[model samples]
Target: MIPPLLSRTILATTLSVIFALPAAAHFQEIIPSADVLPEGGDVTLDLVFTHPFEGGPTMAMKRPVEVGILANGTKTNLTDKLVEQSDKGAVTWRVSYNLPEPGAAIFYVTPQPYWEPAENKYIVHYAKVIVDSFASGEGWDEMVGLPVEIQPLTRPTGLWTGNLFSGVVTKAGKPVPFAEIEVEYVNDSGIKAPNDAYITQVLKADVNGTFNYVMPASGWWGFAALVEGDKPMKSPDGKEVPVEEGALIWIHTSPMGK
Candidate 1:
């Protein structure tokens, strides 16, 4: 038996360690400085792998395997433009693009399979976001033809904080019924979660793979719908590891009041 005071101290320390780490809800963010392009239709994008709600404890992201844009029914390879950066001692990527014409510019990335020690598997999030410029929003709904993607039913731009954002979860070019989606608000500052459960909100797609969520605050909110890839990939140790294919969409919601 141990002394009562010492035993209570040990238990308190153990519980702190247990509750310190929030559940693993990693998000691959393709966040643009501005959702809609300004006069010259120019915007810079920040790409990172991390728990967005916590704004920290970032994970390593390799240089994307593929990075490009699909606009006006044409796909342009922008892989050479990515500039690597570091934050919180983790590697991330960024790029700057100036839209030449006024069409719905859909920027996307296909990152190399990342081996996550926490999950014990490889993760690949095919992330994308739309930046509308010069009032050209007609083609914002076009699909990128990815293995997993979220097709926005609502225009991905010009959204208010409390607005309802909806999208269809598609896997392999088809709707994924009852898919699992995790929501996280980018905790830049001011906004916070009191507990781990409040950090990430989980939702299930309807029969048609559609899901919606209302933004609680004015900031960037990331939606990631996870699905198992059709094929498995090998881990760092050469053992066959399962793959998690995520369809991620990041949108910015503006403040509705002072």
Candidate 2:
């Protein structure tokens, strides 16, 4: 038999050591093994930890971690960094890669579970994804709801109106002007054909988040603006620009002086 106070002290110390560390370690999983590479499009990659909400603290060995995507063994780092699940003690790292054209790419993360007591920090994770060019109508416009205003142009062919439009993209009721706007026109058939039905003119908003584009010719047009985001926003043709929600304004050109 031991003294009562000593017995209580020993029991408390044992409990502290037992609950000090994670019960088990985990690895990450890759999803959508194959992804469509939009012409000049940006791709987002998600690295999911087998453990939930293990973003930082929940990782093994408390190591410095990095996640990246690979193309033919060439690696590209993702920007999303790491995220943790507070409730479940799981973690995830999200990353983005730019795909110039359709091809194959591999992805992985490094230096995970970088702590001591070796048994807990046992898993290193990596994976791959298939990239291919996507057909039309399978891009950001499709991913997010495209606002279609499709307004008519006010001028004739090749005539510069010196007229400009003013507006700003807003989220949560705040103006967001740091974006790119493109005026796109559809063919007479009302369908943007793969060959020659789609026409576009790219422009940028002013300091006040305003723009003035002299309507050149018109069928149907809209404003494509870049919104606030983590990864760089890209056009269908793959031009890197600010990302933002867009508005579609219809334009019908008159025969000049109208």
Candidate 3:
């Protein structure tokens, strides 16, 4: 048994460490069942707002403002097809799309502004992911023209685990110099982070708004380039609050194996 004063001191120290730990970054996930459809069949997409590395405490998401697919220079609205899902009391969404043609399908989502009380602001993440159908090499680099977007310098799909993924952070079709990007892998393999710093990797783009990262593991990785919204929005409390605008892109990698 420990003395009362010493025990109290230890408790205070433990609490301080816990409070100082960095919070896991939130990623707007638009993960498809398969990034490459060999025969151009149906692919289901799971849209969840959560900390991908931690893989828990999924945040509630309202019905998205827009959901669409851009393929072959054509954009089709899929917002009406979203099916609501719930995970541990948090609202999520899913949709299935058929890709009959041989081309790259760019799926994007504009989520409803989420009010985060802890940050005293609203978050609107414009997220997108590319799915190549029938191994079509064409149209892999088409821009969706989102307000905030990532233009891939390297092809977004058909990547090996060690391949370096590079892109430019753009806002309204213009490069955003020195943008900050947060990266997290979908921790499907139950990989534990040694500490808070390993949970999310953060990096800044170059003067040309370009950034790159090598995927060390085989899984879906999300890159979110964060910036402030052009204007503040009304919060749930009726207060004007700044918005954290994130241009997010997800890519998948596979190991070289039999």
Candidate 4:
């Protein structure tokens, strides 16, 4: 009869084999159904296998591997990572990350090889994700709405030490070069955070309707970029040149707002 300790060791080895089979199979992909993700929301990236080891004779009897989410540049490992099992031979892994700014996020899945490195090896594949602006809203009309382009030129966020407000102005459709710009203050209601409050700054587009200007104040500010030509070449009652659609306006309020 086999000793009890020997039997227990065999059982443990069997379980490990079952779980390590999938990793040995080949390369896979985990995550991001759509390229563009809604900003500031829970992001769930699904894990899927691919070439090097999709479903085929190469695949082993047991399938298990590691998956993870890479936000901005940080690596969040999620392999062999355990989750409550609802049924048999099933597993799930999930994580959440907050993206405050608009930009791209990347994810990768690394398949681990169970066998020796010389004979078989594991690899990883990457996927790109884009986080859209939070300011977008139902009220925002593509044909005509407030401009969302707001960027710093020289002095990025702080007390006003000098005179110079410089930044590029881009509308939804095309870049607004030398656009007629204006600055003002709007009450902040959306973002409760003082730093995110709406402050106003007006900028005039350059010869191409792109705007680059400066503000004298250090408080929060906002801006409105209108496409009306310089000097309104036509009389008010005369044929009115239509204002281009996708005109943009940006609003910001600093902590100093009263």
Local distance difference test values of all predictions, in order: 0.89, 0.40, 0.95, 0.36
Lowest summed-lDDT stretch of 10 residues in model 4? Answer: 137-146
lDDT for each residue of candidate 2 in 1-258, tens digit (9 for 90 to 100): 999999999999999987775443232333332244445366554454333222223342232255555454445565345443231454444455566654434344443432223432223332232334342222111111112111212221122334444444433334445456655443333443353223445577656565556544433233445344334444444655443223333232334466
**What ranges in model 2 sit over 4 Å off?**
1-25, 32-34, 38-40, 51-64, 79-89, 114-121, 133-258
Q: For residues 1-258, what per-residue lDDT tens digits would candidate 3 score against the true structure?
A: 999999999999999998897876888999999999988999999999999998877999999999999999999999999999997899999999999999999999999998888889889999999999998877988999999999999998999999999999999999999999999999999998898889899999999999999999999999999999999999877989999999999999999983
TM-score versus the correct structure, for each prediction: 0.91, 0.30, 0.94, 0.28
Q: Residue by residue across 1-258, what tens digits does model 4's lDDT show?
A: 899999999999999987655322222223333334455454554343322111222222123343444444455565545232221232323334544654434333333322323222222222222223342322111121113232333332222423455555555445666665545432223323243122223345676544554544333333434443222223233543332211222222233444
Could you tell me the lDDT of residue 71 within candidate 2? 53
Best by TM-score: 3
After superposition, the stretches of candidate 4 with alpha carbons farther than 4 Å from their true spots are: 1-156, 159-163, 172-174, 187-203, 228-258
Residue pairs with backbone overlap in model 3: none
RMSD of each: 2.8, 23.1, 2.9, 26.2
**What is the number of backbone collisions in each predicted candidate, taken in the order shown?**
0, 32, 0, 35
lDDT of 1 by residue, 186-254 (tens): 888756567678989999999999999988788899999999988888888888888999999988888
